[model samples]
Target chain A: MTGPDRPHSPSGDGTPAPRRSPWRPRSRQGRAGPLTYLVLIGVTVVSVFPLYWTLVAATRTNAEINSVPPPMLPGGNLMKNIDLAYDQIDLTKAILNSLIVSGSIAVGTVMFCTLAGFAFAKLRFRFNNLLFGLTLGTMMIPPSLGAIPLYMMMVELGWIDHLQAVVLPTLVSAFGVFFMRQYLVEALPNELLEAGWVDGASTFRVFRSIVLPIARPAMAVLGMLVFLQAWNDFFWPILALTANNPTVQVALNNLGQGYVPDRSVIMAGTFLTTIPVIAVFILLGRQIVGGIMQGAIKG
Target chain B: MFKARRRAGQGSAPYLFVAPFFLVFAAFGLFPILYTAWVSLHAVDLQNPNESTWVGLENYRKLFSSDFFWNALENTFTIGVISTVPQLCIALGIAHLLNYRLRGRTFFRVAMLMPYATSVAAATLVFSGLFGRDFGMINWLLGQVGVNPVDWDSGRWTSQNALSTIITWRWVGYNALIYLAGMQSVPADLYESAAIDGASRWQQFRYVTIPSLRPTILFTIVVSTIGAIQVFGEPLLFGGVSGHLGGAGRQYQTLGVLLYDEGWFNYKLGYAAAVAWTMFVIIVVAVLVNTTLARRRWRNAA
Candidate 1:
């Protein structure tokens, strides 16, 4: 994209885009460098190799897997495995359930977090420092620390079987608020708020109209992060929806947890579940990382 | 328009603005933990929540006396250290390599982070198949190199090895992206100037790259320490599902698994709460220490 975006380099009389030495160049000891390059490539392969293997392995049958060596390439029978997995976990219902759980969690967290972040950033108030400090301080506490009581409370409220049990408790996230506040405090201009106030605008109105529009990019990053965390969460759903309303991860866990497991079907299920999250990173990978860096730099 | 009710001396509404956070925190965050402590002081049973006795620090005493709890603590710390040190090193090194100017760097950058986007459950499942002793690829590859098969889940050290394998696979890429962000902030001009002064690559990196990445290193340490310390899924799954006690002798178990076992499996609410508090204390101390050290480093560097 960058190659075609610029027709010419400014260093010369507009000939064309500058060239490169393939993917990378090296010094005179370039031979030594490919070893380093090989190491880098090896690590990269090790990283994504499992994914490739899963894609290939999902299509093969158990007899093929249990051979002297595994199949090094893809095979047919993908449809058969998918059919088997559908009956095993009710793949359609599980996907819908996961969507509901992750979607509600993401949207709810963003709404509340944005509202609170706007208040902290644009609203004038006392005890703000102390409250924000405590908010930042809670990042230290691990989620497992409160698992037992949260479970008990959910049970007592009779919210155990509902999706709200998982969704409501997680709807308010500290990290999201912190990220949003960091963005809003800077991105929102003071003069705009002053003008709105002079025109008799309410605080909430000012925030809803002015601040939110400017903070959309950061909000996207926060929303994505929260969604991923909730999507990939294992502990909460496993405990909350152990038997009934099993999430995709829990259903996937159930497959391997059972006796006489169908490894091919499990692999197929694994491949299917990973698509949404992998797609997220593939699209917004840089922006997410950059957003994190910006927040951390300020923090 | 909400008017200021300052005649009664009531002040700011920021508390009102942030009420939802506090409410959720109090209900789910503070209340549960405080209740856990209260429950831990009493002898509560799952069958009868009403018929319980207040037994004060006895739960703590029992935990101290039990060798199973001690083994789980040891396993947690061992895996935490083993996985974190090398994981951060690899992350830092990869981030450095990634910071270099090259063609198609974005492909490698995004590709490197691909592992983290995969679900842990699926990743662990595949890793289990790979590390399986019989007909597993790792063993088969070892055989080609004239080495013998390793029973990965057979013993104590093997348990850590298996657990670390899963941890490294899941997190190494996530940390790399963060570190890549860190390495990018380091001005390229610093290195170019250092090169002009004939500073070797090793010297330039040691003086510039290492120092510049201090905050990121600290960030990773704080986060990785918290994560590894509270590791649950990989160990639990690797320990075998329904093998809730985490192996025959509680060998590979961490605090999260143990707490779950005590609370959910055995129905010992009070005892599990006590374990959770201990885990909380350990995490608190770690975060506090890292923050303090980070502040000092920032001050000295300034």
Candidate 2:
């Protein structure tokens, strides 16, 4: 990828571009005290050590985990422990179920939120502010308020033990709509939308062609957020689906809740379930953090 | 031409665009709230919901009188305060550090978020092992320091501490990132001017940064309070297998857990709905009270 046109193409001086900022809180740029580094490293270690411990315990036998001065490093029984977890619980099925549910939820939420967000952000309609305010108000209604009746409705719909019970209800999040609206209001230009109108494009056509590409970045962040929350959701899925149709979070809960719990197998299951999300974080860490911070500011 | 075309689709297109959200909300979100309110007034059993008898505030009465309900509320507040107070302070400190022109800033920022990114189930289970009575890392570490092994799962305060530790670990970074975003917006010249005045770093942080970050702090406090009131997964997993109703004596059961226990386990749908409504009322009141008090404090400080 390196070429003469590249901004950071190696100059004769052999120094890469100065990427660090000079406008941080402290005027003395690049002069962080050693204590600052030490504290940051300590925080990083504390943040990551529990997950590492999960891995360490998962790799060891239950006896090793339970013994005095438990094995702190990776052990050789990783495969055996994972196999036990897989056999005891249909771990693969849970993973597949989680993927399907979370994927549907994320995609559905993103689409619906984008459409509504575009309307509220750009399209002129009577009662627009009131409607958007209504959407915002829904965010305050705790999910716990609707739990019992929502479960009952699922049962009445004969959606019990179905992934749709978990997926469908959450497909249109209020926060998602609000987030997309805020982002699109800033990212999208009214002139571009007007240009579409002048070209005889219908609203839907304008959204499909002109707005979708521009909103892709915001949609990706919102989709990732919805996916992570859906993947990690527990209480509803636990109530909606039976053990045979468990999502990963529910499956992990079952594993952790077993009588005479096997520490190795539980840890192994935890590790397996978390790998997808951790992988997502590694890949989309910047976007996720950026989206969260943006959400806070706009919210 | 643009105005003419825009007027053409003004009749139904907007409604069509936003129909899905409203439709879904109507079906699942709005209807359920109304139904829960309706069911809260009746003696509804899970098995025979069709034949429920109207109780008419009886469930609310029973809930108010029940010791378990009050105990769960008390525990929820205790765990909420324990976890949220220190979490915000630490988050503020980390955010302050993060605002500095440090090396590998991006790496540190990303690393801090790993806790918030991890699923509650995974995080709780890992903590369970770390806080285990025997052969646990915390106990082992304490032993090295010539302290007694503390039982995290038993007793009242210790179990709450264990739960609070998990909640704090999971959320502190998230709040910190929010604070960091707020910090980045503060005019850099404020610090420069303060420095010119020879204000010490601590003094600058105390007077300048703290005052400037008031709105962000208020936002976090309201959000944390809302989140803390419904703290469920941590205690559920912390209670261990078959220990979902808090601890053995319901030592750490929150209102969220209480609703689950009453509705799912006890089949008292009516009572559970009452508990849910109570929690809703309490959250609204708490948020209002917090906002007013914080506003008053800000005025007094000024």
Candidate 3:
């Protein structure tokens, strides 16, 4: 309900978005009406059941898994599965490769996005609108359209099997820049910068002193998104990863071709793969949601 | 003097602040995409790059004439429509359920988003197990109702339908979270006013809530459409490594999968590039239609 050109209207008609329909509904926050906590909790259970299943399945032996109802409890074979996976696939190496590729891509994306976002959001340059529009317009340019050329470019650059091949291509994601710009546009207070300038603070000094601190929450959100994307990414890395520098995902895929469906190790690899994503989400779910909403509303 | 010093000190700062991105984007982002267009014009082969012949419109001609390309196009659209409409609609319903004065709402809200953050690889793996013909949970459930188990990945419709179910399940909750956010933004006073005016909950939703959520709905529609069109990982992982072939007998493949097959798997760089451009056009066109229709719905509802 925020208006760009106008002063804050709060919630459009002065209702202030109602503070989410009252946090607690009278009789008992525990249990009272048809709006019982159990129903919602049930939903929460359903949603997380698959994740729990993944963890459980990671522990079970293939035959135990093939049992009628499937085990609801974790099996003792988790360590064995991990050991087997390490033996068959380069589990440790794959994890390290994933970290390097995803970490580098995430860092590269943040740097490019923040820089471009800072330029677009704060610059008074001519054609700033045009540049931003062009950037935004490129958002609609599907990634597939860029795929063939990107592959050729990688081959030309001799980066095909290199982790750099994956990192370099998606470094300047439009969504990243767009998300950061929107966040900064909201978070940066013009008066502070103007005041800093009045007291002889340079633009860089003002930005450093005034903007970056306030932008941490937003940046963290963008950073998490960047990390999530890099982690979940399959295509470019699959194209890029060789036997030497295979990411976990590619390793798992290749594992399928290499073995006759070793469910124990596959489950282990999948579970290991999911951990980083879950950790990131646990830490920064709110920022992710907020940043995403901010980006969508404004952009 | 202070202002002058300030201006001088900060004169190049903005450019400095912004250069890293522009440089990287130029090198990796802009350059390759532009080169892809040039590549799309030629008869370039990844295996034999030196034998590149600049056959003008030849790649485009070949892509346009190919039956597989058309099939991919059709699959992409069909799957996108099937998945997107239901995904967003159910997402809206889930959002509403969450918005309703449900206890443990916060739990549901967060639970709903778990699917969104889940690795597509893991989820697809899980889904493939669930959709297994012999022992899938789905087939078991179907058998309890006395329906025969269908070969979920064999026939065109069955395969695409199975793929779309996974797509729908993964996405519906994600979209619901989006709708929940949008719903949270709508002024409760509007609902209050509607309530006061003898409008029932459903009517308030039909009249007030839906109207306020038009922009959000439009946003979701566009996002869902793009997401569906770019249906890569599911088909790639579950469908096959040779994703361009789409599905078994090429029935379940989307444009994204097809684009990969042509460009990377098959080495039909030029033809694949054309296919990519075709997808780009389709996505743009779909976005346009989504926006137009959303606006119309908003207006008519108003």
Candidate 4:
């Protein structure tokens, strides 16, 4: 059920626009003039300034940061501030915990969502459409609605302060399932499945040998999205895990709420917490942009 | 015999594929939600969640009468409008600009999305520093322009505006990209035809781009509305030590922060559940209203 097909090529990578012919009329999508560049540059600066300031604040002393006309440039105290942040809170443990938690969630969500999405997209089964609709419905449920009871459930299970407490509940994202289902519905072809069945392969066997390979790109995109979400997840993890055993976001929360409120140390922790995801973003920015655009059209 | 066995295997396979998601969701997702509805009907404390006293609609009754509840609802509405309206409008403009053929398109896109990549806690921490009373960058910039250094956290509108700025900064790029995707899908000939008919750039955008992107605009609005209702970590971490209170006057406390306050700080687990449920109801009503409006628009167009 393709809607309006994308006017651009299917790759949808941010390829440079082709050179316009001199004879052609200037349409709305014509080459941008000087004014567009000025506006875009302004927006980009606004976007990146906060993140850049995080680094600057992290490098300065509390007094320097709080002074009138605050220090716009970074100081030489970054390493020392980072060390102080480590002493103030369990920064190392928090980063390690975040890695474990987000890694497990990404892998788990990708695996489970791919399987369920494949079924919803292709297989004929009882209540297939209805179950798919139910999964979509779950996305609309505000996460706070389940927090109190989920917290109580964690308490009963003795999972409070445990990594699994945060990891387990989030491993099955409705959006992940929906995203995969949408991708597979279009990217996968029926003939491929028929060929696998004709070869007498078991469904699971076919899935492993055929579906998995086909789903790799979408899986990678979903994995990155899920990882970023889990890493940045605040509300649930703050509830389920304690400060003693915290993720990056939880540690940042503690840093912000500290009694003395060391601005440099807090900024250092915030910088440290954000760097890994930002690194990932830098390495895979184009793909992630494509993924969001692709998801937007499908969604 | 082989055919029959293969048919049997196929019959059970789809269920096997879907069972994991359903099982996990049943335990962690669906059950907890229904349990929250039940929890709201009782008097439960954070210290002793197991010992819940059934209070019927007492928690709901208290919520209706609570001034804090109304204040939070009002704050949520005001902040939602302030943040979302300007955010979407700016996003539309940025998306329109980005649609023009430009150099370094990838860099522009990735840079604009940097804020989205930043976690709420980190972003809020940085923005709070920028919005600080005496020595903040925003105030410092305003001072250079012959304006007084405004105390960002002192008044209702001021604090709310500060919070809205944080929300807008984080989300505008994201919504712009989504809008750009929608604009890209618009048939180029629609623009060509408009241009042939002597429509200028702004006229073409107003006439063609906006109409073609209605569904996409609606999608972003609905998503942003849901996010606005649950605006948590930004306000929670905005006011330093008294962050959970949203401000000294609780001026910018959203429903999300209020839920945390009722449960964790006040230790009223039951009342918090009631707030959570009420939020769920509001989201549902809002989404339904959006859908109805969209449907009516389509009918009139038809």
By DockQ, the best candidate is 4
| DockQ of each two-chain model | 0.37, 0.45, 0.37, 0.61
Please write out the lDDT profile of model 2 over residues A1-299, one tens digit for every residue. 01112233221123343455455333421256889889989999999999889889989999998877777799998889899898767888999999999999999999999999999998888878999999998887777577888887777788989999998888889989988897788778889988887887888899999999988988888888899889988778888887788999888878877763588888999988897788879788877887787777644
Clashing pairs in 2: none
Which ten residues in a row are the worst by lDDT in model 1 chain A? A1-10
Off by over 4 Å in 2: A1-31, B1-9
Q: How far is B30's C-alpha from truth in model 4 (Å)?
A: 2.0
Q: What is the TM-score of chain B alone in each candidate?
A: 0.89, 0.94, 0.91, 0.95
Indicate the residue-level lDDT of B3 in model 1.
39
Q: Write the per-residue lDDT of candidate 2 for residues B141-219, one digit (tens) a residue.
A: 8998898998888889999999999999999988998888777666666877887787888888898888988999998
Q: What is the clash count of model 1?
A: 0
Candidate lDDT (C-alpha), each: 0.74, 0.84, 0.70, 0.87
Where does model 4 exceed 4 Å of error? Answer: A1-8, A11-19, A23-28, B1-9
State the lDDT of candidate 3 residue by residue for A199-291, as single tens digits: 766666776788777766666667777877777777667766775678877776665435436565767777887866776675666556555
Worst 10 residues of 2 chain A by lDDT: A1-10
User: Which lDDT tens digits does candidate 3 get at residues B1-302?
Assistant: 66664545445566677677667766666666667767778887878654567878888888888888788788888888787888788777766766664544544555667777776777777766667687666777788889998878677888788788778877777777677667767756576666667776678768876777788887787778878877887887675443446655888877888777876677777877777667777777888988888778767866
- Model 4 per-residue lDDT at B209: 94
iRMS per model in Å? 5.6, 4.5, 4.5, 2.5
Model 4 chain A weakest lDDT span, ten residues long: A1-10
For residues A1-299, what per-residue lDDT tens digits would candidate 1 score against the true structure?
11111222121113232354443222211122554566678778998888887877788887776567678887896888888887767766667788899899888888878878877786766677787888887776666577777877777777776788888777778887787887777677888977766666666666678777887777777777788778888887887776457777887777666662667787788777776678777898766555554555534
Alpha carbon lDDT of residue B247, candidate 1?
A: 67
